[model samples]
Target chain A: MSPADPIQVHLVRECAQRTKYVIDLPEPLSLQAYQELADNLPGILSSVFLPSGDVLLQIKLLEKEGSITGSTNSATLHVLLTKEGHGRLLEHILQELRNQ
Target chain B: MIDIREKVQFVPHLDCGSLILGGEPHVIHCHYYNHFLQTSIEDADGIYPAEQVLVGTAQEIGHSQFRKLFQEKGIQDERERKSFVEVVYSLLGMGKVSLENVSAEGGEISTPYEHYAYTYAATFPPRPKGKRGVAYFSQGYLAGAIEAICDLPLGSMGSRQTACLTQGDPAVSWEFFRLREPLPLQPSVGEGRYQTASLPQPPHTRVPFQAIRDAVLGLPLGPDPETGLIEAFDVVLTRLPGNYYALISERHFQHMLSAIGPDVIPLVLDMLVESGHVCAFNTLGGIMCSAEWDAVVRPYLDNPADWLYGIVALMPALGWGIVEPLTYPSSHSWTVSLHNWYETTAIAALPNGHTLTYSPFAEGIMNGILALVYQAGIAEKRLTFDGELYGSLFRTGRTYQSTFHQSRLQGAPTDVVEGHVAR
Candidate 1:
């Protein structure tokens, strides 16, 4: 959690089923950590950096639905956030984005 | 504020599974059923003078309901009557309205939040031109309320949805005027034919049906004070009169069969069933994914297939009637029987309903439960509810299918639907 990294979480919507977080990456991922991130706390609904550099990394957390999620790419890694504890982190991230 | 949610008490006939609201037989239904049934009704627009049946049916029911409420509650003042109608409209999750400008002479009112206009708009892509809009339910209800308030007869007032949110309009607006000639209409067949039996307790499942049912019943799914829309389960919802859905659906199906000929039958039936599919994905999926489900029902889940049992066990609370699981051989397959089901029971009671081979709506619901629960692994948090995911699960190769072994609407003892992965 370095201030130098400055990850941007654009939008955060809490819906009936899941929490949707839209973020813009300041820098691309290593592509090596795809499997590791896919195996954790929040499910990656759609994490695409695309052949073009456009990014849409929507991460969702459904409690008790278990922790395995996300899709991999030969291209640059799409998202690099492990937002396990959904409540305050989401609110804090949104507040940070607002402050920015 | 009228606060009709407080004024109109819901007396639940727990035995028969009937919910009586404002002296009308009301049942809680999600947007999926509402939009689909409306599509089926509006499908017969060309040949049948469908407006009479579509809007008129709502008018008849609204007229009856408002009249009863007026007499029972002794609602005499015109201003109060107007407030009561608008409040009840929002209370049912149909969205808000402004009745200040409406009167016996022609007048117009508008809303940015009519449920039919908003949800129905989302169901389809915005047209480049000519969106007739989908707020007829609210349209006719308001029209009928106007009639009752003005002390006019049932068919004395006429209304039109001049512009709606579905049409890409900023607000949904309707114009009401005294009809030059009152349309011929019939009063609603109140609380149509109902039969009941004690719910079955199969020895195989551990999900507590009663507690979940009670929990759902207790949720105060009322409208927001500002917006006046019931937003829950990730979708706009309504506690509608079930008979209105039944009559409109049956009339459309019968008319399509007779006037349009046998060629349209398959398409019509498919659309009817697809409505149920929509319900399962949105309504049922929303329920399964919600925090309330986590607190109330999710802990009871042992096997993935138990999700199916947990869902059906409490559907009677929605007043759709009792659902009993006959067997759950595997996650890929199962069989469940519906007894005294709402759609079938209503159709069996209505005169024109004899022609339906199966309950199109219910069968679609069966298909969705399998497509979602077992195939899509909804319980495992894999469900994303996007178009691509929906296609892969419901339309692509090796999709789940449902077969009706018995149909109670056709006089069988009980309606049985068996689901499994397609061969």
Candidate 2:
């Protein structure tokens, strides 16, 4: 869960099963970053998610303000890890972000 | 002056609209008799009476006496002044000057020959490096030409027509159409036929010139975030004399697509298209379809995971080509036979192993599988694309089946005897 490899392949798969959105992170994300991503929800008009630890996650919006309004037509989310989810294995990271 | 006896008296009536001005030896009594006559009507609404409106009797009976008395008391109290300037020619002496015909109408004058020269000159193409014909002429030259014509002492307002012919037919005017890029010629082969409706011919009306000009003068203009747009262009529409109008603001144009919505947007798009105002449709990104597209596909388009699914459903609705016979070529790639040209949309996979698509019509099969893989990866707590197979493409959409089958026939070479190249 470093910035260099923020999004792991496992997270994308997990996101697809639990929710309609499948977001992959390329780098470790921060809580503040996740909030900022959520704020852009109106423009993206699509569902977005950020895995925070194993049980908590953040959401963002997609498909918002159109071309005329200068919106980029995208929604980006960042997920961060909590102390409990730290592990050499990605399973620990998944456990931290998942609600269960 | 005549004096009245103290014993003389007058009767007072409250309902009567009359006023007594004085109580001296001579009493001046004013009566609004017409007002009383009109007041009796049920629907008079407290307006002046009809009798009072007539000039002969009610006027004489109510206020004529006062006029006569005033005239008797005034004599020779005003004087007139001579204010006319006289002009004399050398040949004429002792000629009386009179105010013959004083008119209030103003006029305009023009120089047509000069305009004609400029226009005629413009008929010839410009030199390779210099500005166009009219533009090549210095501002001062144009100004001098204008001053010379308007300076004509004997010219009539129609002289302006002469100036127009002389200077040039206005090749460019405030009313010229403004567009950053040219429009598409015809709907792309599979693109839906945008319905067109006749808009009110742009009103041949003009706003007050000064008011419109003043609206932008010294005003603080800037991008407003609340409107979610940027300033882009401005124009003035002039269809009447002595009237100028601001037809547009660049800032407003920025958000026009979303603001106008589907119903009225097509009218403008039609105009732009017909006029060659938008040059190209370069990218498949952005929300190009009208709100109708959103309304019809809202349930599916909103989820990133269903991006491909949603797009497949909308293809037929959009009248764009459909994706059919989606065959997975490999674990990470899929092949789709499109009913129409596929340049309008495409999809790609992100470095994070999640699939991202930019198809305005439908998310391809490959992107859907990528979505599944990404979801599985998240659940497994590993950012991996290991199980993602591109070749196992799933076919969707009833429209795709027909389109796919049709494409097979249409794309086949006539001379092909078997499943080999025609050659």
Candidate 3:
């Protein structure tokens, strides 16, 4: 979470027909941080709020690339985010990084 | 929704009749149709057969337009198609149309009443008071468009304006329902005649103002100025050309007044009042002296109802409003309301959308006509504004109200006739 130990983010091509970006997180953050990310992701991705208080992410096709990689002491996992999903994930990461 | 800016270009179509500015040919001119068609429908008493024909024609036209737009645009995608329809509706001033649960079968479409052409048309002359949904043309247009867009069999698709502006609804809602059987074909009554034809032709031959002035001066005074005035007007009405009404359109008349400026309007109106009195007295006197006076006119004078219809029929040909009987709330008076007035229509058509100054010419004529028809003395004749659009003509024995709403679209310096008739 320090300035020197920044989260790694890179653009990558999934195939000849498609391209995406990958984000490698420094650590599996606290549950509270994850919760905050989930809450703010919708507003970051789509400005409109649904009746159920959920936001539908509207991302352009070009922004749909990449996956979010989270690692712990024992294991690593990757979650694919659409363009809008990528936006929400990045916003959450920036917020957590700023807090640290 | 596909951005229209990316998908289409709007160049003005060469043909004036085509409502579609650009895109492939699918001409639909709802505005023109709304103005003229509604005028006809109003004239025809808003008959069901006329309504049915309008609906049928609209649907046919909708089918052709939709077919062309869909085909030329290659709009097979559902979202794009919906967007296309909405854009088309918005462009045509049908309001921003939205479809829900739309499929090959049918859907619910909704639009704000503000965009409906009928919302504006309903306000036109002979404005409907407390009437049900009068957006007959819009209803048909939607139905026809949907049937074509969905490729529904003719008459299988039915659309109704569930909510209408005329009914005080904020938005017009239409439910598209499938009919078990095709709609029964009704004999087509040709499009009703447009009121544009009824517009007064400009007076090519002018009547010299001096001649009228001299005629007024030379009118022989009888027992009193009132009696002599009536005799003079009767002579003018009888000997004047059939197109004497055309003189009201004389530019020289208006130009002369304009040259005199607004100061002369009152003086001119005072002259009109005297002329009105003269015309009324003449009419009554002529009827009294007629060969059939004892048999026909006398009975009507004795019983107001007997002669009312004859007077009503004669008034419109003389460029007046339709007269309907109104029950007199008081025992002492008889009352009738004039509907679909020609004067307000003419005035409303002037100066484009703005109002014109009030002219006492029509009012005076109405007063004169009412006084004679009711067999009331000049002193007993009275005219009063009911609302900006309506006026009531009252005589001592009977009352007549004009249903025509005065043209609010025109500008006037001051009201020519105000307050109750001066005692």
Best by DockQ: 1
Cα distance off (Å), candidate 2, residue B401? 18
Q: After superposition, how far is residue B149 of candidate 2 from its true place, in Å?
A: 33
Better of 1 and 2 by DockQ: 1
Tens-digit per-residue lDDT, B314-401, candidate 2: 3222222333324422223334444332211101111121111112112222233333333222212323222232112122211111
Q: Any idea what lDDT model 3 has?
A: 0.37
lDDT for B371 (candidate 1): 81
| CAPRI category for model 2 | incorrect
TM-score (all chains, Cα) for each model: 0.78, 0.18, 0.33
Model 2, span A1-100: residue lDDT tens: 4556544332221111111112244333444443444453222222222111121222322332111110122122222221222233234323333321
Clashing pairs in 1: none
lDDT of 1 by residue, B145-260 (tens): 88888788999888888887666789999999998999887676666666676665556667787776766676657786776877655566888777677677777777778897
Better of 1 and 3 by TM-score: 1
Q: For model 2 chain B, where is the 10-residue window of minimal lDDT? A: B237-246
TM-score of each model's chain B: 0.90, 0.18, 0.39
Please give the interface root mean square deviation for model 1, in Å: 15.8
TM (chain A) per model: 0.36, 0.28, 0.39
**Cα miss at B91, model 2 (Å)?**
71
